[model samples]
Target chain A: MAKTPIAFSLNGMERSMFVDPGQNLLDALRRGVGDLSPKYGCAQGTCGTCSVLVDGKLQLACITLAEAVAGSSVTTTAGLADGSELHPLQRSFMDNFAAQCGYCTPGMLMAAKALLDRNPSPQRQDVVEAISGNLCRCTGYEPIIDAILKAAAFMRTRGRP
Target chain B: MALHRGRGFACVNYPIGMNLGGDPSQALVHSTPDGKFMVTLSSIDLGQGMKSVTRQIAAETLGVPVSDVYVDTADSDTGPHCMGSFASRGTHRVGNAVIRAATEARTQMLQAAAEELEVDAADLETDGEGGIRVRGAPQRTISVADVAVAAQFKQGRTLSGRGIFLVPPSEVDPETGEMSPVTCFAHAAMAVEVEVDDETGMVRVIEINSAYEVGRALNPKLVEQQLVGGAWMGLSHALYETTEPYYPDRDHLPVDFNTYLMPGPGDVAPHNIAVLERPAEDAPFGGKGPGEMCANPVLPAVANAVFDAVGVRCDDLPITPEKILRGLRANGS
Candidate 1:
């Protein structure tokens, strides 16, 4: 298979790389782009560990073809932090002890970011529904749900994204 | 259509560290020139907070701030030997070794500080804030950083300690077939409530109340997280997850998470936890460890809850709806 050039904006920066035709976006991001935050877990897309934001939409990088989403803006958990300051979601997750092993954190953060971006104030059920695709083997989802709700409140009070 | 609600309870006792082949964990604690300390061990974290807990243990033993201690659990090639992390033994086994090593290092640090101050080593006491002061005079203090510099450059004393924790092997009595396999045991009890739909044969867990005697919770939050995650794993094993649908015949094997069923956030029930402290005599900081014990009582509790709700004993795992429906038909309900 011949390698094709795919250009996209990642974390507010434009990046271009030659990717294998059959390679998924996850491999393109991790190997080509050197973005290790979006982990390669259950590459079949069941674990939701490879979740990323493509053009403001929640997409699984493992199943998404590299060339299919060319020129799209991709956001990962690494993009959640602004320099030294962490995002409200990340802060709330640490404060509430949401993550245990930290393996499922990137996906959970992406899923929560997608929800909060759409609805600034979401109900508990809505939060649950948003991260339903992501599986966390630690913290039992209670702390994760609590952290998302608390992050929503924090973001609402700050009146900023 | 009638829905039956039922409750069930189960208890379990799990040993902290197995003594098979002499369970051993080794740790090396050394001080840097900047007063910071590093503990190197081969025990893997496995997301159970082994690094954090061992750092805490070492800091407490060394009479320093927890942040001053850095635990390196990188790889077995560089660090000292450990029996690996499993059987809920990291905290108990590795922590004990860390305490021993940190204690020896602390003694060496105190001696160096005493030499720097020209005072008796026994007259010096650590302030737990990286300061070594005279026992009676709080103002007469020397910073640990200054002591470290003097110990290495002036006194030529290397402030380092090594420790290895091993449970003595107990011989089994040939006639009685009795032997203590581990140093300490952690205990847990769980009560589960479930709702069963007679027509659909679907079982849903409503609530769970669990109590665990973890000996000591080094980090209470970590302990609770382990328990909650473990209980969810139990619920998944009891009602949802199954690797072998037709045993002895490898057909329809699940290759993905969608095919291999696991509990999601929606399947999670309300869990109330009560942590009891029953300190172990020989364990580190009296912590017998509670990692693996969290999932032990959940399986039997959920199984018994299903039996109570539908009056059917599911001897097999993953008491699926199909299994419950067959049990209901057999009971002629």
Candidate 2:
């Protein structure tokens, strides 16, 4: 397979990579770009562990084509934290014990980020619907829901510091 | 067709560890020159917080702050032996071994501190705040860091200890056919409420109320997470997941999360939990691992709830709608 050149802004940094034609964004980012935050849990995209953001929209990296993401800004769990300080979602997750095993955390965090970016104040049901695509075998989805709501409140008040 | 609601209850007494031949786990605890402690083990966490629970156990036994200890789950080549984490044995078996190793290391630390203070080793006590002091005199104290520094540089002593725990196989009486395989047991009682639709034969779990007796909760947060997640898995097993959908046929097996049915976030019901602590005699800090048993009671409770609602027995797992419809049609409802 001949490699196709695709360029995109990843986590606020411009990077270029050569990926095999029809290669999914997950494999391209993990193998070609070396950003390992997005995990490959289910390659079929049923499990949202490979969730990432393409131009600030929730996209499943496993099912998405790397070529389609050309010239688009892609955000992942790796981009959530700013240096040593954590994002509000990450802090809320840590405080609320929202992660176990942590295989689904990157996806959950990405999904939550997508939700908070659009709806700054999400209700419990809204939070449920937002991350409904993501599957977590641990935490029972209770604490994750709580963490998302908590982060929404913190982000509304603190304004993303 | 109308929806019928019903409630059912069930209880379980789950054994702590596997009854296999000498289920054993080993641990190694060592202190760095900077006073930070490292606990090495071969047991895997597997999302059950085995590493966190064992770190807490080691820190408590060593009389040091929990942050001062780091748990390293090393490979078999580097770490001590452990009968891999399963059957809820990580907390109990691995915890006891960590306590033993940390205790030994603590003793050595106290001896080195005593040598520095020119006092008897028996007279020294760890302050649980990174300091070693004389039991009676508070003024006579030395930091654990200073003690470790002196022990390594001057005394040329290595502050390390190794431990292993094994529960020998229980002897079975040939005539009576009885044996005590497990030393302790964790218990649970659950009541589940469900609504069954006679039209579609769909079962919706309204809520779950349950109590667990996990001997003791070493880390309540970890225990709570396990209980909560385990119950969801139980619910998934009871009403949703099945490897064989067409029964007795090798075809039509689910290969991914979409084809394989499981409870989504929307399908989660309200769960009310009450954890009881009746410290076990032989458990480490009187704590049993609440890893596997949290899901046992839900399976039978859900089945019983469906039986109460539609008066049909679902002996097989998942209690699929097709099975329920067949049962309802057979009853001529």
lDDT of 2 by residue, B164-195 (tens): 88897887899999988887899999999999
Question: CA lDDT of each candidate?
Answer: 0.90, 0.92
**Cα misplacement distance, residue B275 of candidate 2 (Å):** 0.4
Each candidate structure's TM-score, on Cα atoms with residue i matched to residue i, is: 0.97, 0.98
- What is the DockQ (computed on Cα atoms) for candidate 2? 0.81
- The residue pairs found clashing in candidate 1 are none
Could you give candidate 1's per-residue lDDT for residues A49-112 as a string of tens digits? 8999999899999999999878889999999999999999999999888988899999999999
Collision pairs in model 2? none
lDDT of 2 at B195: 98
TM-score of chain A of each: 0.98, 0.98
